[model samples]
Structures are given as structure tokens and as C-alpha cells.
Target: MNSETWQNLLHLESRDIVSNWFEKIHNRKLSARRAKEIISSARQGREYFRSASTASFAVRPLLAFYGVASLCRSLTLLHRWDAGEEGLKQGHGLETVAWSATLSGDLHLALASIYKLRIRTCGGLFSDLVTVTNSRTVWHVYDRAVPMPVDNKKQKLGQELCFLDILERLPDIGNTVSGGGNQKWIRLDDFIYSSEFGAEISVHGTPDHPVCIEYADAGFDLSKRNDPYNSSAEITVLKADENLFRKYLPQLIDTRVIRTMGGQPSPHLVSKFPQGSWFSQISITYMVSFIIGMLARYFPTHWSALMGGEKGDAIWPQINAAQMYIETALPELILEIVGNSIFDNKEL
Candidate 1:
């Protein structure tokens, strides 16, 4: 792709769009221009994102996405790792697990919008990486040719931040964690908070501009996620593309945190995101919907064909089962167990 194409892909005015949305809806000061640059890029990525079919199959994208980012220092990859195909596939619990999962794209967008990265590709030298995105320029390194880490970071070129590229590591976070080790997220913020829960995202400097990026909390909840496979699996992302804050997330909506505590051994412990799960599920589902909808339009009809021995007439049962697992049953179980634990701990 040419620079023009790359511009179209990466320079979408999503920030402006989202900022404007907030300005209009909440009457808050915001920059809609940021969202504008990445909308098209996000759409383009959707093409590859939804190509993933099953829960277990989605892990590749999820892990690979984050694996690419080194700045995401603390990640519970193993805590969230899926151990079995049954857990990855047969268990209808991934959607629940992914509720807190965040995408790196959101963080990247925030980083990129806040700070721009200059990508350069050179032969043999990692600093001069052979970036294929746009700049069709190849060259010898200004500095002596030095081997670079297999990772995507062009350290030689002074590219330090690692928020955005990480999402490319895993396809579906829930799959990776509960449903068998996949990674995914929708609504960019979901990615941010999930990736850096209780952790601070420290941004040191910017180009030409002397501004520093600060967040009260780098974490955004994955309550809303776009899941398209099953309607019951459908969950919406909170503040999907809305211009939240250039610096800090405004209100203290300890929703999912509450939910997390709810499922804890003690109620006093208090979950972090009571409402985040729903929001994460919704947004993630929305993203999945967009991907599935887009792909369904182009994919052969055979792709939609049911492989199950069960009759299509019994689809309602499947739908109900999905809802029970994703919506009602799972939530009830989570709350029944963790809610009390959270409350008890909080009291203590």
C-alpha cells in the first residue's frame, strides 16, 4: 500500500468522530479528529479479525496481537491461558471470561493519537526494519547493521511505546483465558483497561509537543465486546468509540470491579467491574458482529452451513443454550459466588 493508502488506513479521523460524538452527546470538550484516522484501519483489520471461526481457533490472533508489544510489561498470559480444547471450545464460558479482556488496539490508538511512531525498515539492521505497511523505502542503516529482536519494535529508530501493536498477538482474550487461550476485544478502551488493570500507563514525552499523556487509571473494562458467533454470545462494549477523555476516564463507574468482587470467595472482597462484564460482552459482540457481517457478505454460503449433526430446526435450542451459558447462567454463577466474597472482604 502507498503512503496515501496507509494514510487512509491509519489516519482515519476516528478520534474526531468520537470526540464530536461526545461533544454533541455529553457536551464535553473533545477531539473527534483522533477517531477519524483509524476508523478505516479498524474496518480493514476486521476483515482478518472475523476470519477466525471458533473460540479455540481465535487464540492465535489474540496471543500474537499482544505478543508483539513489549511495553505491556505485566500480563497474566498464563493465568488466562486455556488448557484444553474442551475449555477452548465445548465450554460456553469464554464470553464470560473475556469480559475483562482488553484489546491492544485501543491502547495503541490512544498512544498513536497521543504520540506518533515513525516506522522504518532497513536491510539486516533491525532499526531499519523492512516495514511493509507503506513507505516503500529500503536502505542501509544509518548506524552499523545490528540484528533486531524478532519482535516488531524498531528500537534503533527510537520507537519505544508498545500499546497498539499488542492486540495483533491474540485474537480473543476470553478464548485465551477461559475458552482455551485465544485473545480478542472490541471498543478500543476495553483493550486498554483489560491489558493494564490496576497498572499505570506511563507516557514520557512527545514529538515537537511538550505535552505528557497521563491517565488516572490505564485500565478500561472489557464489559462490552462484539461477539457475532451466537446472539447469546453477543455483548456490547462500553464507550466503544466515544471520546472518553484525552487524559482520564471521567466518572468512577466501578461496575465490573463490583462484579469481580461479587464472584470472589468473600463478598467484602468486591469485584472491580460489576457492569463491565455486560459492557465488555456487548462491545466484543458488536465487533464480532461487524466482522461476521462483513465476512458473511463475501464468504461462500458453505461457511455458514452448520456442521453439527443436529437439525437446523433445533437452532432455537442452541440459541437458548448460548444465552444460558453467556447471559444468564454464567452471570448468575459469577455473582452468586464472587459477589458475596467481594462484599465480605469490603466489610472487613
Candidate 2:
């Protein structure tokens, strides 16, 4: 695509369109918490776009559209919630739940878009990807290049963190674990209250920022820690001979770390790279086309109501035009970005 086309694609109409729409809706139907979640998701999508813009050219369009699609999905969910609440107030419980499930599925697709973009950028390197758990924990050692799974529920969010701890200890580029595996395993009580490690392990930035493991010791405590993951106590192993520890790292990970206490791997673990393949590209194009068609056919009146109340009719034409472009032009652009041969032959 030329520079003009890129500019047009990035031209998200006017910033005021979404902001005004959100403000009007926030004042009208959404609760404070729900409004906040919607705004936060929108902000995250923008942040991801900003981050993607700084990335190399090969994956820029994928990342940029991933952000745009995320914002679109969030707005669609907001619309669904607004439409569903009327029925909800009228005693349609099942219908309300169904609407919420649809919203959840949209959230899943937003994540999937990001996951595909990341895979394109990183060639599916597990270490470079950040696995976002259903509980919202973002697990990754690297700061950038973090890839989240499309389906959060299937991720082994907690075990992945443990697995990262093991990876951090391994002999890699720039990592040097102090006592190797032989460092004395700190007691759970000792590690938690140890003013030393406590001072070292302070939380910084927002929860979305990468978790810092600096100056932290990993050892298993027999008692459980106060974490949502419900991980076992005494899970960290501190001290072992360097050579022996290095030799057994893979075995330890395979036998103890990757699986849950129940000894089953997370069924939702995202191990396959489905994006950029011919089938995946076609599927995404078709899905986007279908959604655009639906919006054009059914959503203009509803959107007009949301944007301008009962008298709002002006916004429908703009929406219709946008949907038309999405159906006719956006699919080809997306296929061009994602269906390229360069992305197909990449190895993790």
C-alpha cells in the first residue's frame, strides 16, 4: 500500500466521534465501573497502536489494524450492552446473559488480533510472548515483544509465570543467576517477610506493565501463597549445583512446572500459530466482511439513537459509508498485509 492509503487506513474519522459517543453513552446508560472498563480497553487499544507504530515495517499494518479492530470490538460491545439493558430491565435474563457472552467473545477476538500480529512480528517465539491469563496476569520476561493468547481462559497463566522463572534462571543472553541452583532455598515465611526481598520486589507502574523478577528468589514453600493462581507453596527451588541444575532444567520444567497441581496441562494453552496462513487470512477477511455487512444492515438506526438520541439521523450515512469501505476495501488491505509469503515461511 502507498503512503496515502496507509494514512487513510489510520485516519480513524475524528477522535471526537468516539469520545463524544462514549461521553454521551456514559451519561446515559453505563454504570461507572462499566464505563471505566470500556474506556480502559479503548485506551489499551490506543496504547497498543502507539507501540505497534514504533515497530518495524513488516508487521506495522497488522499491529495497527489490530488496535483499530480492538477499538471497534469494544464499541460494538458497548452497543450490545446498551441494547441489552432495555430487555434486561424488562425481565429478559437469558437474553442479557447472551449479550454479555457476545461481548466476551468480541473481547476474545480483540485479543486474537493482537496475538496474530505478535506472531507475525516474533515468529512464534514463546519467550518473547507475554501470556495474558484469564485472571489478567501478563506473564513474560521480555518487556516488548509480548504476545498474549486470543483465548485467555485456556492460558496456563500461573504455570507460565513459573515456567518463565525457570527460563530466567537458564544460561541465556545476559542472564546470570547468582548461586546457580545451589543458592539456599529461602523459606516461604522468610522470603515473604524478608525485608530484603520485600524491598527489592516492589510493584511499579500499572498492572499492565511487565512483572519484575529482579532480586527475587524462587523456592517452593509447602504453604500456599495469597495469589489468585492458587499455586502450590514451596514451589521455588533455590540452591543446587550449577552443572546439575543446568542439566535438569528441561526435565524439571516438563515434570513439575508446566502442568498444574492436578498434573494436567492447560487445555487453553495457545501453542499453535494459526494467523498469516492462507486459511487464517481468508477466515479473518470473511469475518470482517460479515461483521461489516451486519452493521450496515442492522446497526445504523441503533447507532443513530446512541449518538444523537431519538432525533439522531445524520450519523447513519457516515457509518454506512465506513461500513461500505470496510466491506469492500478493508478486506483486500488486510489480506495484503497478512497473506504475504514473507510471513508464511517464518520459523519460531
Candidate 3:
């Protein structure tokens, strides 16, 4: 996280600032009692993040996950005030139904043999948050030729999801989770808007490698505009008039608007997966953190072995990346969600 924004969040530790911020977002008469809870919850969440920053990777996930949970509680308070404190008391709304580790005669092999971990949604705080953000999928990150929502509406609660599959969907660590393959998120170099050709917006590919941006909607022309500098690079440009561009303006904005700690935004075009197989970035964060925290808390022997055993070298980098995401990216995401909920312009 940037130092300036981190300091700004620290300032919210002041009760007066939090209270004022809360009231400002609502722009209405405030509830003194609820205001106190929101202040306390946000403080608690920040402290957890602070503590997580100091801890070693061995135990960091636990602290970080709880910190995220606390922040989510604060957001929940802001969004679902009708539920009140009683709603905040609900369970995590997620569970690890089955996790199996295969054993070999060699201790190192046994330690490395964590075969599978699966979790199910049990309808609690986490589930509620997922439902609220379900509309914003990986599909929303692009303009596909066939613009159909991935049909996840019928996705049943309590249906188990492979822990690795969900972990593989994280925008940052996904490549690591996929055995060092291509990134699930393709970061765009630029989105150039031109009015010369009736307001044409070009989706530039990452300059470092060749990319094929395809399946644009009808009336939007897709031409092979490869980068002249790199013979192998493919740049997909979508052409549309000002009116048509306005139709996709919301999605285009969302695709580019990943805010940093100081409210600096970057553009990353995401890849789409099958319906019910993909999730929004926030849900992925919460679910992954929850799984790691649960493992650290409940499976002490295995967790310790996984951290220090033979495969540790390979796994530690991903673990460290997860921690970094929790520390830096997670807060920005929470702020974004809360800001959107309150219709606030700024995310502090």
C-alpha cells in the first residue's frame, strides 16, 4: 500500500473522524449508538491488518482474514443497518466440508500431498456479501460477442467448491495457483478513446506479450491491429460510435477502475470462465482468506508442515503474495465496495 493512503486509514482510528465520515456518506441524521459500533468495528479491522503486517508468514493469514472479516462487518453495518448488531453476530456463512491429504512413506512427500480441500456456503455473513456482489462477474470485465450472464442463479447453496479452483481465480495469485501458467487477469496497457472515427475506443494489449482480444459484440468491429513494434503481439481494437460506446461505458469503466490505496486506478481486462465457475474479485478474496484461516486454525500439524516442509519453497511465494493482497489490495477493495454502497465519490 502507498504510505500516504495507509496514513490516511490510520487517521480514521480517531473516533471523531470515523463518525464524521460515516455521517458524511449518509448525509442524514446519524445514530449515536450505531455510529459507535461502526467506529469500533473499523478500528478493530485496522488493528488486525496492522498486526498481520508485523507477523511472520507462518501465522499471518489468520490475523489478516479476521481483519478482513471485521472490515466486512463494518461495511455490513453501513449497508444493512436494518439487521443491526444481531445480524453482525451471525456465522461466517462458509464451511470446509471435506479436505483430504494423501500420505506417502516419505515425510516430505506426505507433507506435500495435500490432495484436496473443499468448502460450501452455509448462508451467513460471507454468503450475504456474495449475493450482493453477484452481478459483477468476470463477464462484466469485457464485451463478449455473446453477452449472456454466466448462469449462476441456480447455483445451489451448500454445494462444495474445490478450494484450489477458487484460489486459481484470484486476479493476482491465480497464475501461481495454476502452476505458474498464464495469468487469469490480462492487464491492459491502455484504453485509448478517439473521437476521429466517431468515438472509437481501442483496448490495448499488454505490450510485453502477444494477446488476442476477441468476441466483441455485434456492430463493434474487431480488427487484427497487431502492435507494429512487436511482430507477434496482437492488439484487438473495438470500433463503435459515440452512442454505442455510451452503451458499454459502464462496463468499460468497471474494467479499468481497480483503485489503489491512494485512489490511483489501473486497468486490467479479466478472462471469463464458465458460469458458476467464476467469482468477483472480492468474493474470491473473502473465500480464499477464510479457507487459509480455517486451515491455520484447525489443521495445525498439516499447516505447519505445509509452511516448513519440502514443498515449502514452491508454496511460500504464493502464500506471501496472498498476504500482500490482503494487506494492500484488500483494503482498497473494501473501501470501493463501501463507497459504491453509499454512492460516495471518494474512497478513503
Q: What tens-digit string does per-residue lDDT give for candidate 1 at 178-201?
A: 223222221111212222122111
- Local distance difference test, candidate 3: 0.56
Q: For all candidates, what are the clash counts?
A: 129, 15, 0
Model 2 stretches with alpha carbons more than 4 Å out:
1-27, 82-348
Q: Give per-residue CA lDDT, model 3, range 165-235, as digits (tens).
A: 55454555545374755544444444444334433334455323222232253245556476776788766
TM-score between candidate 3 and the true structure: 0.69
- Candidate order by TM-score, decreasing, is 3, 2, 1
Cα lDDT for residue 346, model 2? 24
Alpha-carbon deviation at 298 in model 3, angstroms: 1.6
- Using all chains and alpha carbons, the TM-scores for the candidates as numbered come to 0.19, 0.21, 0.69
Per-residue error (Å), model 2, residue 15 = 14
lDDT over C-alpha atoms for residue 293 of model 2 = 31
**What C-alpha lDDT does candidate 2 achieve relative to the native structure?**
0.28
Q: Who wins the TM-score comparison?
A: 3
